[model samples]
Target: MAIMAGPGDPVLAETAAERIRELMDGGFVVDADGQHAPVHADDLAVISPHVEQASAIAARLADVPGVLIGTANHMHGLEREAVVVIHPLVGYREAPACATGLGRLCVALSRHRAYATVIVDADADLVLAHAQREAPRDARLATQRHVLAALLALG
Candidate 1:
């Protein structure tokens, strides 16, 4: 079962780990290389309120240089903000939402590029992991550089 913390307290890493455990139902199912494991969960419905709160916080955090994931306030800030929007997985898509579990977040932060990606949940581990994914905050870090480059090249 997923451990619940106090209303305002930050979720401990262990709590996140525990939640991850609960999502997978105990045993971690990893692939051949053991890079990313499978996670089971669906939609932002589980934590819509939390996603809203995080989005609010992200709105406040906007203009500062950070990306908030999983909130209603889609894109924030001016000056060519390249936010990586990861939609919730309908049915085992390539990239899934963090609402379901941290495994997909792990995959994205470990693999995909995102500067200020918004998650559909208030999972701090996913946020921290994404932050750690791109330490220097490359707004264009996890973006389609090729497409962007092509567009820019036309200009």
Candidate 2:
């Protein structure tokens, strides 16, 4: 599943990434090619809407036992057990300026086939609202919402 963390806060993104690493037992791997390659238990992947953020996260996780970081573009068409998306709301409001970026974020969230997605952000409602507006008639978005609801309900 694809998880989102944001309002474009770097601190939150970093913190969320760290927490996820802990939950995964410090196991995460980068799909490098987004080929849906096999990942071990210790493998962890971080996806970000911005290259700078992704790179920063990668650098911060450099010493982690088992973690890989990259932008959503790098993991296109790939599937993993879990994916953490940081600062997904970066350009959510500025549609024109971030049209490509927003599209990338959506593609990253939708294309990546994960069992669970952990979205970390202060304003999840805003994120959802923007997403609904962006893709009101998209079936994929509907499915994603359903799955996310189910996951939340399970907890």
lDDT of 1 by residue, 23-79 (tens): 445423345686654333221111112354344434433433323234222322221
Candidate 2 positional error at 68, Å: 2.5
- Per-model TM values vs. the true structure: 0.21, 0.54
lDDT of 1: 0.31
Per-residue lDDT over 6-28 for candidate 2, one digit per residue giving the tens place of the 0 to 100 score: 33446745665675666466444
Which 10 consecutive residues of model 2 have the lowest summed lDDT?
91-100
The Cα error of candidate 1 at residue 132, in Å, is: 27
TM-score of 1: 0.21
Clashes in model 1: which pairs?
67-116, 68-118, 69-118, 69-119, 70-118, 70-119, 70-120, 113-142
lDDT of 2 at 87: 38
